[model samples]
Target: MTKSFRNLIWAVLLVTISCSDAPKGETKTASLPVYKDVPYLQDYSIKYNKQGDKLMLSQVFMDRNEVIQVASSEGILRTHDGQFLYPGVLLQDKTYRPLTDKNITAITIYKDQFVYLDDKAVLSNAWAGSLYLKHDLPKANVFAAGNDFEFLISDGPMLQYVSKNKKNWTGVLDKDKVKAIKFNKKNSTFWILGEKSIASFNPKGQTLKTVFQNGNFTSFALLHNKLILTTLDGYLEVDATTGKQIGEKKTKLPWTEITYVDVIDGHLWFGSTKGAFMLKKDGKFDYYYGKRWLPSNNVIHISKGTDGSILILTDAGLGQIVYEEMTLFDKAQYYEKQVRNRHIRLGFNATLVDMDNGNFDTGRLSDSDNDGLWTTMYLAGEVFRYAVTKSEDALQNCREAMDAMERLFSINPVPGFPSRSFERSGYKERLHDPERWQHSDDPEWDWKSTTSSDEAIGHIFAYGAMAELMDNDLKDRAIVLIDTLMSHIVRNDLYMVDFDGKPTTWGRWNPEYVNARPKMVGDRKINASNIIGMLQTAYHFTGKEKYKEKAFDLMDNHGYLDNLMWPMKDVAKAPDDADDWSKMLSESWNHSDDEMYFIGYWGLYKYAFNDTLKTKFKDAIIDHWEIERPEKEGAWNIMTALTGTQEFDLEEAAWYLREHPMDMVSWNIMNSHRKDVTFLEPNFREQTLSEVLPPDERPVQRHNANMFRLDRNYAKDGSEEFSAGDIWLLPYWMGRYLGVISAPEKNN
Candidate 1:
């Protein structure tokens, strides 16, 4: 039963294979389809999905479409209701529509036209404008052998020939000297505008005759049987059929030195300014400047494809404009895709100085000083520009609000700029105060004044952003401030702003080590906030390779990077928990020192993605985020700031941002058991504007003494919102780089 059944199956397969008319010979040819000289095939390509038995083609300005079957090795075929008609050719994904489909058979694929067969297997001259419309360039094979005078323009080339009633009218008084030719259908006469003289060719007399002279004619054309000639002087129009003089009109603008003229669709478009011009049928002419439209203004050989698309050779790079309708979405999507790949990501750490609750607000959390809110205001400007280009007018109000913030920046100078002040409050003076606070005079609280680092980082970033999004007037103003700050920093050669208006070499949280002091300069390290800020500002203005080099250099020398190996010894080890020195890295008294060391590591991973440094940065970030000791909770602000990098891969960053409960808040103190401490809670009031504005203009939110805590502690059942600096950075940068936004829900 098995042997006879197998024989029967083999015989059936052979019968089917024989009837299929497969390619000849014992060996089958490669199944991959081949197409030649199709211009629009670059973006559009087709692949045969053998498993599905379908040909997938790239649709023009659309989605994918499957093909029925490919026609031949030399050409392409499309069927209407199953007839094997050579309708056109396929350039991978784009299908070129052919002129006729009645009797198409064996065909030769060409750039502009389909030199194909009728039903009788006869070669025919037929082509369609469909494929040319797709890419604006004519396919290559459209031209037959030996056609002289080819012009290459943006679209393609054109082949020109003169035919007057089937006679090659030639050899009339220096035929080679003729520069222009026109046809008068009314009288069957030809007006030849030459370099030195204008002549009229009469079909009846068959003789060379002269009418107008003086101006050297460069190019001319017959429009409605009138001879429109171009010269250095202007345009001279005459009736070619009657040989009667018409009005001679001089152009207000000088007549461009043109060499060719084409009257298409009621527009007398010609080549000049070494390019082209379109003269309206109503007698007004418009000059299109530049080779973007034409190859040259001279008769310097151009070619037109069989489908009439022009190709011209010019000095500039190839430029193309398809004479077809382009949808709005198509245009926006084109530019959007190009720019999105290069969109730079920037993240800032504002809490370098450890505040009462392991975080620092601009001033006392009780009074609304809005240093933390500035970056979001800057981000709003970016959203405004993006919205305007997209025509989303709802964002216009956001733009106006950002402008108000810029006005504040210009007027409200902190320690860095002495000329301006928002108000005479403890907040403004706190910028130069080293102590967290002091009574009345405040004695320039040194720790609070240390915020000049945070302010420099914040203001510079906002300045660059404002310059990019605003107009020239506003951008110039912002640039003045930016340049001023850069100059000041270069002059001081120090990290933080010097309180008491004197140079002091303090580095990070270390009181004895001056950042610029040569003795301790080796210990100077840039944190995530400073490094990202510098890289961003540098990238926006100079776009120099050196700025990128400096970024990579700092990341490599000071901290662990994406993939680079650093000896573990290079990292200062955590001191023994019981030792007096161990208290330096402890959350109780030394949280600020721990933050200083951790900041540089987090900044590098977020901004730099060079393959060589990625792994090392990742490992270091994971180590910092996943540490499970009790003191690690104090590291939450640093952890949250690094979360903006998204390099930790802990998956808890997103959860931590939203999970800050309403009632239970954590207090930061030198001793956990000490009642005297700073509370860290969330404050939801938009403080960015509040920082630079008067109390009357500030947005108010219900608050309590525990508002600075990460969790809600003031109200029973823990139902208060927290407005900490870290929470804002998480959602803001995440939404920016990932493009996911918690947009207000539509329809209320």
Candidate 2:
């Protein structure tokens, strides 16, 4: 296929699945396509019934592969796959006999029985068990069931309760004011909705309580011992036993008109004129609309399918949402494109940029101190992606990214010292932070210097990854870049010397400085490991004995192994104080170092030439990972896979990608008041939640940011959402390179 054609196909795939970044409310200006909600089940049969035949189907239930039963709007019975025993046909194993009468009012199937009222005013029943019979309930207008007990109703709210055994019977609640009814099979109780109050009655006609006598409630569901009542405004949760309101959630207009609310398949499925929504048991609501995968938002009925799909019936047509359980590799393809098309920018001199809105003309972005760091991550992912697929686009993308990365080393005149980033001399925008930028001798461009250790790590990591994975000219370029950067570090007295002739704030790597820190300090251990890893990676790619010699000298002479392996639990924490920079650094774990450690591990584990060294280094990794395992982070877990670590939870890493939300557009997501999350108590340290939420479930967070942060509730003025490049591509391609996931076989 042509490149543009393939790109168009991928774009169609994404826009069809997830929502676009187009502005909401009155300001939509992208001319973006309306989101189409496509059924995950690509194969489906559409039946256009006979012109006179009733076309509306209300409820759907399956009998294995035998038949599919559907209820019509006229309250008649319909079956598609095979005949049923409704007209004396067995509800058990016998086939159904077609009904030509078309006089059936309504058919209700609850538990193991199917009940219907014929035109002759006969209430006939079909039971899956023995004992099929008929009862006389003239003008029976309603049918309900629970715990194998049948509830037959006529006018004036009169009711007949029959035991599961088809033996006993009684008139339970004959309230004239009854407006609605619901049966709770879980607790063997039935509820009655009235204008003034709601009542719950047991099978024995005993009153559970008048759960709500004070507030106006439209609908309700019995959740354990709690009554989840839907009021005019929002959801109201009350104590079922005491009839006292426990909680209330208020919302605006359209959602207030919820007509059908039933807990189906463990999710609360609700319908209104506005749209259809399935509220997760955990309280997260996944909304469905006509534009996005539905025939219409005017939901008439919501049900379940035999294969675990959601069956939706709207005003226009029936829609089935099949689970799009995509393979890990297919998802990777989508995300990789999401990054390239929207997030990445390649311009003058191959300078790559990440735009906040994933757009260029109107969106804003500025030079970052860690620009190379982010770009290298994207480059490494492509290297691994190309190694697995041999895709030409991935190679071309990497070449461009490397051009941007390589420019950093040559833009400044401080030997092999790389500037953070450089830009055209006079194009600084309104939001740009202007402290560190200065003009280069050429005067044509300005560069940001006083670079930290992060850029160097990113440079060496990407270059080494390319040397190991690429066979093209990129590998030669990568080796040259690594040699120049590694030489700069070694010759600068084991420090990343800055343009100002002083080590940048965080660029120190000299042994004397690392060893002088307190034993409990994280930097002491992290710095030793990063320098050793860099040295080891340099030796592996260039076959330099001096690089190897330095790695051994650091470990043997400075106790680097012991330092790297220091148990994290023994680390000191800082007390809350107004001003004390010395004590402040030790409080809580520095997650920034988590990013450095994982990046450093790429070299430590992948190029481990010494088996003894690899084993000890692996032991420290295991120690660090065990403390971090609670975070359930995909990137961290996938990076550890390089050690060939046994039982590295490869499946879990893939699960993270599958669960990550498709909406990459950044928003201010505030979850502090969410009823579902389990919040941790206040502490000086940052992790606000008791445990780390999955990427999609949590508020906005970058990869290196504290995974456990309780809030991104920060001012939304303009924060960039996650890009597919680093957040997604890293784990996905890593899985491909490690053989945890394989390319799918094309179907004939």
Candidate 3:
């Protein structure tokens, strides 16, 4: 450690430092995402102990195959071959002056130097074997820093800063309370994470306005201009400058008590006892834990490695994860396997099944009233798969699903009247009153008969798809069913009559019922649109004048055309009716109607019997879509694209595809507890999210639930294995079918 060698090394670094615009000591350059396509992960280990004895690895420095590791008790230089070369050796031998400080609390690779903290901080050069020890370092209660300055939080409930000029930290705030400190070099600002408030301070010793209040956070990391914090609740994203919360993120596995978060290669890597996980730039999570991906789930710390992999140091071992982005086909295939293997049943398949590896078969999947509706979506996925690849497996799946859907109508006594669901004679014997059941013309089967409009919508949707895409038997069966249903509706005054010989709760389309609502009610526009669509679809398949006649009568005489085409925003609440139904219909936008609007669009746009009506239908679709644009739903975007709407937001549609998780198992995802998400003041509709929606806000929701969810906590009952609404397959296949997305290049 001589001045001559110090000057020599500085001179040597001057050439390399001059190559970039960055200053001499500030050599840390940010990296782009390690992956640009779909991201996949692999893990390798660097265990703390080479043999049986455990080495508490606090930090590691890599130089090709040679590694210098700093453990709690000592430092070791080891080769990649599992050989410890510097056994019982020091960072500096007796030939040089050694650090006299005992109990080196920790060591880390910091900006342009290796920092070892004990009673003081030692700055060393791993290559030159030289060191600079600043013995003035305090046993700081709380400390953190940015590229230029180190901050300390003392019992004054005060703030202090240390710069290169002033080796001793001076008080930035003469007298004020502060809490935790984190500095981001990119913006040259220090963030205060505290018990009651979050505030910011600059290196110039100026305090900014408090960003947030009454907050609690356990850990946080910096991603470019944003700060990501994790608490016992969940993870959150925020802006450092404005203190505005961006959104909350949902992890695949719940992460709690996070000790650290590291932003590397444009991803957020987390360290916790639950495991180590990285929130990818694409919004998916890569969880690393257990023996397969790591030595243990008890992750303590994480650091960047030389090869762009993460250095995962646990209490027991060390590991590394190399990330790669896969092609879209790979992503689709993985989810396809999840559905085929776990989400299917012989008579009835739940939309989702248990994903717990330990008890996958115990209380797996969910029984749903919309089983027919949910099953058809999967069936439609297979139909598209068969159309694309002519796979026999896909054909069989489509056929099996059609059988379940067709059974809904036949199981009921009223011809062409589809029941909501059917079960074995006594499965629900005690739950429902005897009046709710209908025998299947046979003694063995009983079905629930008070079917809602949802079942009707689902039946026709699948029926139309099969008629247009499949073979003779399916097409004829679908056409015949359409004829029977249309005849029944026309005979019974435009309502879906239940087996009880009365209109079902939500199936009424009579003009008295549909036209009674105010012009502002979306329900008025929505009902007129749906009934007209059903009539048109019936005519398209059967070429029957009666169906076409009904469609025109509704449009011409009842003003159905005006009902369907009015702009959504212009709908006003008529003060005349304070009835609960009108109040509910007029008070807020109903995203539940969105599902009906979309499914009905298939017939409204693609199967309209007249070209003149089809053009009008196109205008209606565009009007509704324009207002829903902020939701960024893929199916709505892609389905509307089939009508040739200009600029259908294709990239955003693909983004939803790639970002939606493959694990459809309804894991518990709660966002109500996030400290970083903006919650709006209570309004009539009661909104929670202030600006934008985060990707993983809830786990395993259908497009219906996803678009409509206003609260962070799920309002529904008991957590199910599935959301019981498999929706990803529809948009994914629609993208493929519409050529908006193609299967990855054959080799890929």
Against the hidden reference, what TM-scores do the models get?
A: 0.31, 0.64, 0.64
Index of the highest-lDDT prediction? 2
| Steric clash pairs (candidate 3) | 38-325, 38-326, 39-325, 40-324
Cα misplacement distance, residue 127 of candidate 2 (Å): 32
CA RMSD of each candidate after superposition: 30.8, 14.6, 14.3
Residues 212-322 of candidate 3: C-alpha lDDT, one tens digit per residue: 553566666777777676665566678766777886554433356576677766667787766666665444455554432344566766767655546676665555443
C-alpha lDDT of residue 144 in model 2: 54
The segments of candidate 2 whose C-alpha lies over 4 angstroms from its true place after superposition are 1-196, 199-218, 221-261, 269-325, 347-362, 430-434, 574-582, 682-685, 717-719, 745-748
Q: Taking the tens digit of each residue's C-alpha lDDT, what string does model 1 give over 65-121?
A: 222322232234342231111012223213434533342222322332343322322
Clashes of each: 61, 9, 4
Query: What's the lDDT for all of these models?
Result: 0.33, 0.61, 0.60
Candidate 2, after superposition: displacement of residue 410 in Å?
A: 1.1
